[model samples]
Target chain A: MSAALQDLDARIVRATQGGLPRVPEPYAALAATLGVSEAQLLERFAAMLADRRVRRIGVVPNHYALGYTANGMSVWDVNDAQVDALGRQVGALAFVSHCYRRPRRPPDWPYNLFAMVHARSRDEVEARLGEIRALLGAALRAHDVLYSTRILKKTGLRLS
Target chain B: MDELDRVIINRLQGGFPLCTRPFAAAAAELGTDEATLMARIEALLGDGTLTRFGPLFDAERLGGAFTLCALRVPEADFERVAAQVNAHPEVAHNYERAHEFNMWFVLGTRAPADIARVIAAIEAETGLAVFEFPREAEYFIELRLAA
Candidate 1:
């Protein structure tokens, strides 16, 4: 959050609903509305991206209608020693769109690492599970693949 | 303006109306006929451009508590931990980001207390820690691709 971006940035960040303007000079249009130059708007967007404040600017579709009705979030409790190597392997899978780990539990929840796998059918998703299982060897004492029965609003983070 | 795209996206975002003649209603709104609209929608879906066209429910409103949780799983137990967390039906989208706290998943429960209880149960079962990052505010990114 640069000082130059503090005010307008917060406003724009707050307005992270709907889709970004779909126009050639979209930044210019936004700048016009914000009382700034197109360059300024573009710079803000670019800077936000550089700072990892925004992950990406792209379309997020409804996977169900596209035939990926069966989506599962897979979680794991990898040993600290092998967490990195195994996490990289799991994350590299094409179907595993997102993979990461969090602090384990005592005061918190257990099952630290997680990954998401999407497939057209449950069987397809399950097949990947088998692959993951084989890769992890006997280390995997417990694992669960929870399928989504319905979507409860899958939209992007609010920016404004 | 690409009239067709505008029509399609607008219709898609609000969600496909669940009716016998849903396409017909959408066509009417777009100033087109049912057949043409259906054909175009079908094409869009076939091309992998449109992910889905249906209801997007509000989980929190539906009496479910959801929070973003992460775990620092060891490599050896990754698969096992994943299995345990996935056992809960409330878990939604999960991600494996490149960070120390790597395993992230969205947890939802019928009651607010269920969220904590479930996390506690998971901790006891797996003998590890889970970092719950409940959403403080609602944020929706507006970044749809124009193709």
Candidate 2:
């Protein structure tokens, strides 16, 4: 990255890490703080979005507060060769918030594919898991759901 | 959330504009005025429906280290262990999952090496082995809930 672009990226991370200003013209307010024109700041934001540096710019709702209290980390032990294809299918599901393929440890941790499902209750989560099971079919060897009991800590990314 | 609120949530999920008057731009698209759009967003945030409104940064891309770690805490020592684990600033978000390896959390650090140090400290503090699952690949990760 160019020095100028790197500097802008750092500034963007710092200025907005806390949050965007809750105002009618939040980007404009932020641009004033960073001593950049509104158009320049927006251009940099668009560039970052295109490059996948910033995932998305919008409201991040609290699932628990929004009645999605029952969240489960659904793990699946699928055929290693078929995981990539199967993972894409699982991730396409609307209820699956996050889906990824991580390394699996033998004997102790055998699940490789992880999908997070959120719902109003555990029963709803279980029902969704059943849908995933049907989707996996013969490829799924074993699976488990880890429902969160408590949130010990919750905070946004702090760059220090 | 009423119809307008739902519209705001659904429309904003795609993204907020980067114009001089972003709210005004969005309001025009949603067929509402800027003041009303701003007011509804403030209300939604104040009510905790929206945890935050801003950019979502990728920690790894910014030379930061993060990983999903889990610990199998004994039934009796769950709360004590959770307290000990939560005391560290490096631990961003920790959750108590219902499984043998019940306690799961994401640890973020300025340097990659700090992750091991934090895990060691937690193990020493709680006397439990910490299982780390660093993301090998990201198939997809987007949290968009329809209202």
Candidate 3:
């Protein structure tokens, strides 16, 4: 619902999307580049985080490198009337990282709810899926897990 | 990864202070020194133990648009099609999964309209139907994986 970041705000995204510099005074360093006071930059960052323009400002461990080898996109066909409510519960589960309700392309794809689950192995992931299955109960019509075979590309954000 | 590394990964997943000496403040709570904490984070990022370490933007909240799109690229055409699909800068992430609609990627655009444009371009370039999955509602999105 938000509009494009403008002026200095847009510059901040372009500069720091890759990451903030790892330094004792990283914000000060960044502010210098943007020709703004450190206090000004911090204020903007705080506002962005509060508004969810910036989701978070911290570690993003690569699941593969951290031994979380099993990653599955578990999709479910839930009753449309109950999808939003059910999605909230599925997303609250400990193992579900990301969850959403999306339009289903009937005949080809019937899943309207998607949840990403990760674990150390396939068995572990399946067990987690079982938990989701139990949670959805009768509302869960069908489900499938799309296990990623390879990361063809994972380039970072591009400034527009 | 050692115990300390694990602690860092689990502890600093969010709420990393935005102060002048943010690492120092975080280190105090983690029972570690700032130098050690900074070094650990640098090493983690350098070796790909961590994919990213900074502000994670919500493109939608920033007036940008994003969509998860998929296409069923046949075995013979995967590699070639992958290259073609990746050629579009809008495609932020592309992955091959074990499903009929095996090729999935996330498209990020500055505006909502740009998303459809990118999808059309990809469909034209790949000669395949682009199945766009735009989220109707996004639930809680907390991704803190214990390392």
Candidate 4:
């Protein structure tokens, strides 16, 4: 990455956590507030997207109010060889909004394939999992589903 | 600002309002027509450029309370636990991070107490220790895939 891109990367991360401007031209407004030219700001934003410096730029909705009352995070244990393939398949599921695999840190923990699913009720989420499990067949290993009691900070990504 | 891009970004956030003729409202604000606005949004979503054009709800406020939680799963059972967790409707997002408590997932429940109950259930079902890390202090990370 170029030095300018590296700097833009840092700025983009900062922007995610920072307050978003409540205006029509939010990006432009953000640039104005930060004292950068609107064109420079747009270019940087565009560059970040092009280089994958930023994963996505969009509003994250509140699912709870939208009848998606049950929000659960589930982890799966899959073989290392099949992790990426499974992750992409799992991530692509409409109900499974976010899915990825992280290194196994264990003693008591043993999950690898991670996915989040939302629904109107616990039953709904469970049903979705059943479908996923059935789809995975033998590839699907032991699993644990954790539910949340409170959200401390729904929005934390700050833009620098 | 280029009128087109400005309109795109402005309508992209907070979602298009839910109502008949929602696009028209957005277009009016952008000094354009609904047909054009709708077409653009459709294109964006189809191209994987935009994640979703829907409501970004605040889980806590809506009543499905949640917290950040993790577990130290045995490497062998990782897949099982993940499937079990994802099966539950309450799990919002589950992520694998670089830490001892490698498996991280967020839970949203109708009642705050259900969060603990659900964790306990998972532990009992999976026979694994769920290292529950309730938020000590809120940490926010904004990750946006640029288009």
Candidate 5:
């Protein structure tokens, strides 16, 4: 990408990182604020979506407000050889929101594959964890679930 | 929240139209008029049902990096340490979990090299070891929740 194009993209992201305006013509409103044509703004947005720089443009619901009070980060110590394959299967589950392969800091953190399980209550979260445990079978070496007691900050990805 | 509100939240989680009149376009598919749909959304936001309603950007995809790090803060100063950690712009998310490594946060920087520097700064500022759990792979990610 050219330096000029990169600069333009960065400016747009920095402007909207807080969020797109909640107005009738949000795109036009944003364009007017940035002093760019509505068409140019839309074109850049489309390109960003295509490249996945912008994941999606929509509402981010507060699960806790909607009764999903329990959020668990369930980690597993699956065999490294089968970790990728197992991670894929675990990720495919309906209840798991985010799943990933993270390195274990042995003796302390022995979990390599991590998955987020969210629900309305502890029982629901436990039940969902059980489903994952059953799927791992003998391959599951060890596991633990860490529940967040509080959210200190959650300002996701900001541009500087 | 009523059935219409739930339906609106479920459907509008993503793929909101980017047009001159997005509410009008989106409301048509939800079987509601533009004015009513806009009013409901405004109420939802005002009442704190929806935290945010807009574009979701990926740090890595946008020429940046993200790293998940955990800190074991002494019980006597959890809040103080959290405030210091969150003071940095790189600390995107900081959560207090029920574990020995209670303070967990994610560091997202525009440049990949900034991650190490921030970790060092945190360690120096708090005098606590920073446990960095860099993500090796992402199997799946879906941020939508039923209302």
Candidate 6:
């Protein structure tokens, strides 16, 4: 990675990992702390975004607080050859939050395609899974929902 | 949430502008005042409606490594094992899912090799096999929750 992208300007990550300030001029406030001009900070941010270092700059709402209490990790057993294409389809569904293709350990774990479905209730999640099932169709040989019983720990990365 | 709250949640999901007065700019677009907009955001975050508000970094892109790992904790030992696994600083998100392989968590480390080291540590600590499922390919990843 280029120096601009390497380590992602540690100062910025360390300073803003918790969050950017909530002030009217939050960037300016953050730049002040980092002892950099607002323009320089924004320039780095833009570069980070362009290089896919920063996924987004926005609010990450608490799904549970927003009534999306039921979160189901819907795992699907898809044909290996067609997993990528089908995974993309499953990922595009409106209700799916995160979708990825993972290595499946046979006998013990046969599911390869994983999509996270969040909804207000189990029924809603089931309904959405049904939609995903239809989308997967033949590619989806079998599937199961691993509903989250509890959140053991949830926090952002801590770069030591 | 009230109408104004919904407006803020929905609109801000896309992005917050980078400007001298971003809240003011957003308020102008949403037809609200800067103070009210800022206040609403603070309230939302304070009340746990918003979990986070800032730039979402890609750990891997930043010269770090991350992996989704699972552990098949025994039903009777779930709590104990979870505590042991979560004690590690590298473990970011951990959840108890209703399945045989019930415990799932994401591990992030500054170096790629630290992933195995962390998993080994967790296994030794919990005496449970850590099933590491690093992403072979990312089909999609978007964390937009519509209000």
Q: Name the candidate that leads on TM-score.
A: 2
Global local distance difference test of model 6: 0.86
Candidate 2 has a DockQ of 0.70
Residue-wise C-alpha lDDT for candidate 5, range A1-160, written one tens digit per residue: 8887788788898888777877789889999988888988998899998988888888788887899999899999999999999899999887788899999997788999999998999999999999999999889999999999998998877664
- Of 5 and 6, which scores higher on TM-score? 6
Off by over 4 Å in 6: A1-8
Worst 10 residues of 2 chain A by lDDT: A151-160
Q: Please, what are the lDDT tens digits per residue for candidate 2 over residues A42-75? A: 8889988898788888777778776888889999
lDDT tens readout by residue for model 1, B16-128 = 33233556666687788777876675666566656543323233542356688777878788778777877766676556544455576777666788888888988997788
Instruction: Name the regions of candidate 4 deviating beyond 4 angstroms.
Output: A1-26, A105-107, A152-160, B1-147
C-alpha lDDT of residue A5 in model 2 = 77
lDDT for position B101 in model 6: 87
lDDT of candidates 1 onward, in order: 0.61, 0.87, 0.90, 0.60, 0.89, 0.86
| lDDT digits (tens) for residues B3-113 of candidate 5 | 989988999988888788998999999999888988888888889898877888777877778899998899999988999999998998999999988999999987788
> Which pairs, if any, clash in model 6?
none
**Which has the greatest DockQ?**
3
Ten contiguous residues minimizing lDDT sum, candidate 6 chain A:
A1-10
DockQ, per model, reads 0.06, 0.70, 0.75, 0.06, 0.70, 0.73
How many angstroms is the interface RMSD of candidate 2? 1.7
Provide the lDDT at A73 for model 1. Answer: 73
DockQ of 4: 0.06
A1-160 per-residue lDDT for model 3 (tens digits):
2343357788898899889999899999999999999998998899889888899999999988978899999999999888888899999987789999999998999999999998999999999999999988989899999999999998866654
Please estimate how well model 2 matches the true structure, expressed as its whole-model Cα lDDT.
Answer: 0.87
- Per-candidate TM equals 0.53, 0.94, 0.92, 0.52, 0.91, 0.92
lDDT of 3: 0.90
lDDT of 3 by residue, B1-147 (tens): 899999999999899998999999999989999999999999999999998899998877767788899999999999999999999988899999999999999998888889888888888988999999999899999888888
Best by the lDDT measure:
3
